[model samples]
Target chain A: MYFFQKNKYKIMLVASTAVLVVCIIVGSAINRRKAGGASDALGTVFTPLQSGVTGASDSVSGFFNYLTNMKGYEKENEKLREKIASLEDELRKTDNLKSENERLRKMLDLKENEKDYKTVAADVVAFEMDNFSKSYTINKGIKDGITQSCAVITPYGLVGYVSEVGRNWAKVCPIVDSKVSVSASIMRVGNTAIVQGDIGLMEDGLCKMTYVSKETGLEVGDSIETSGSGGVIPAGIYIGKVTEIKNDVTGVSQEAVIKPGVDFSDVNEVMVIKDN
Target chain B: MNYVLSYLTLAVLFVLQTTLGRYIDICGIAPDIIFVYVLCYSMYNYPVRAAVLSIIAGIIVDLYSSTHVGLNALLYMYIGLAVSNFASTLMKKNVWTVALGVVVLSILYHTVVLITQYVIAGHSGFVYPFVRIALPTAVYDGVVSLVLSLWAQWLSMDKIRGL
Candidate 1:
């Protein structure tokens, strides 16, 4: 009887496994068809369950049966995460070395342009709790040699100028601000234009390049770099390039849409030009 | 007294909704999984238990959120009562019905939140109006309702059989 029960259970298990295998094949085929046909259907389990499958724990459990059986998956996951963390730490160190090497190269480029200006390194501290604000605060303050009116830049382009200084913190508003004016010139053709800010363009991280003559050689895709004619931006600061050129019927100058290189949302650090 | 399991489930959903569900933003709003689940429970005969479960779910969500405490509990309790009363008038378990009900409940949830945020922030909302957020959110909730209903139905299967 014991052998009979054991044999019966073994048969049941084999039969179910066979059925499960067939079901999986059929399910995948149906999913492929559904994926091919339906605009809204997310055919796979990973596809966001717009159908409310997620609130159902049983289904999720059924789906992730491997995780359910290996209850130590969370522990295993934690262990693997720690291992990944160590690997990431090594990667970060390597990335830092690469960035340092790049910075040294940029420093060489800057030295070729000018010998007088000193670059002050600073990291971002806080953003206004309101995401609507275009301002971000940084770690450097008056004590860290950061002061008001200093031109802060990232590796890619001119970020902003330091606006407010506290004992340990400073606030900066980027050149994309409607009120900011940077003396910029087209690098390819060397035609001068003033990059000006307007409130309508702030949310999009765009500043208008104004004062370009209609007869000027400025065109779309032209790289805009700092002219440094005015002591403000100190020349050679890589701003963005002309993306669109529009001319007003009555106006003398054509408007070139400049796409700012630094995505302010993801900006981590900036250098403040300190040598005055 | 396994209200603890119910609460834990809601907590898990809230965390998942904020962290993972955020990626699935439809028209810029995620589906209201907790609200839809509450809507599902209101389908059953356990009115008082459903209301209490919803309140617990609400409180758990509040704990995870930066919003004011007890607000979700209050919102969910009323939604539970309303859905319970409404559930008796209709009995079909079709996905569309579940989807539509979820849309209504999600609009209600988000309208309250938008109002709350407007009051707190005191800033201008959008270019178009008093509430453009609710419509997209409602549509997204409708889209997500079929699955959320399945969850509620599955979780409440034992209770449904009891009734």
Candidate 2:
């Protein structure tokens, strides 16, 4: 009893160190396993607290997003109105002539004709917000039928896919994360390439397309879209556009830098594309 | 009374760190406020309490973080111990003392994280992360801790009477 009382500080330090090591091992295993009961319980409690804080923060940022993007929105609105007026005039002339073309397009029954899917919408409740990692947590999860690897998209394009799930919250590894890779294709030329995030480019909010064949004739401004080869992400979801192209270090293949279609900094709402 | 005050301070700082403080990123780097607080508090006040608080704070941060759960707690515990053990000799009752401590600790923290996450793992090249993320973040932390230490001093002043 005397020894125990005297050695309390030493015991505490050693015990804490041991606990930390055990936590490291268990934490890594849990991360590898994706989700667990403990994390689910933590999420169940923390999701509400995070959501409350996120709601308040979002209100402040929403005002800033509106203020900062106001000019761009005004310019785009003006351009769209002008385009609509011109299109209206053109439609008056082509109204009768386009009837057969529309009929033929309907007859072809293209995949674009289908505009429906089962999706769960979620709000970004929090962000990882550190230089070492780039991820976000959404307020929807297993309770909302979300699963790992489900493609997340904004109205504009692909954001990323779910990496971890809990009862009420999930973590999304965005396309800008160094760990993320997507099978993408050139919309203009049908050339397939792997769009992967790089640590260097992620700081600037850009991704790189690698392993593209030289014969693909990849060019700047070409739209990139998901190829759906993995089947986790649906085909035809817009990824981004090629901004720069360069030869690989070995010169055997080509690489292109892309700007993602979705503005991640401004995204608040996202839809999870659940598999059928 | 002091423990409660410190605990409250930690809680408020953490909430601020996760919420509004996140938007304060410059060049994709944000200051580590909780880290600065722990280093400063340990130097100025109770060491053992600061160490325990750091662990608690680290766990809370890990709960919200994408990294492995104990990575931060482990780092914070070690930082807490280092600061507490050395504070009596190294720290002085001066703003410069706090400033220098924060500066050195911030760089050390980033270096350790980099070594563990990328260098030891060999998954990523060191040059880019060191230049772009780690160094810039340390600079940011230095600037932030300077101001934060000053504010903490102001809050603790006997003349202020209410804090």
Q: How do the residues B80-136 of candidate 2 rate in per-residue lDDT, one tens digit apiece?
A: 877766765555556676677787888888788777875676545778988898877
In candidate 2, position A165 carries an lDDT of 86
> Candidate 1's residue-wise lDDT over B5-64, tens digit each?
565666556545533453464433455666666777666525666767776666544433
**Which lDDT tens digits does candidate 2 get at residues A98-162?**
78767877899744455576899998877774676678888999888998999999989999999
Fraction of native contacts, model 1: 0.00
- Ten residues in a row with the worst lDDT in model 2 chain A? A30-39
Superposed by TM-score, candidate 2 places the C-alpha of residue B65 at a distance from the truth, in angstroms, of: 1.9
Which portions of model 2 show Cα errors greater than 4 Å?
A31-33, A61-77, A83-115, B119-123, B150-163
Worst 10 residues of 2 chain B by lDDT: B154-163
Instruction: Kindly report which residue stretches of model 1 are placed more than 4 angstroms away from their true locations once superposed.
Output: A1-276, B1-5, B89-93, B126-132, B161-163
Q: Report the number of the highest-DockQ candidate.
A: 2
Candidate 1 per-residue C-alpha lDDT over A94-125 given as tens digits, one digit per residue, 9 for 90 to 100: 99998997799898775443456688787654
DockQ, cand. 1:
0.03
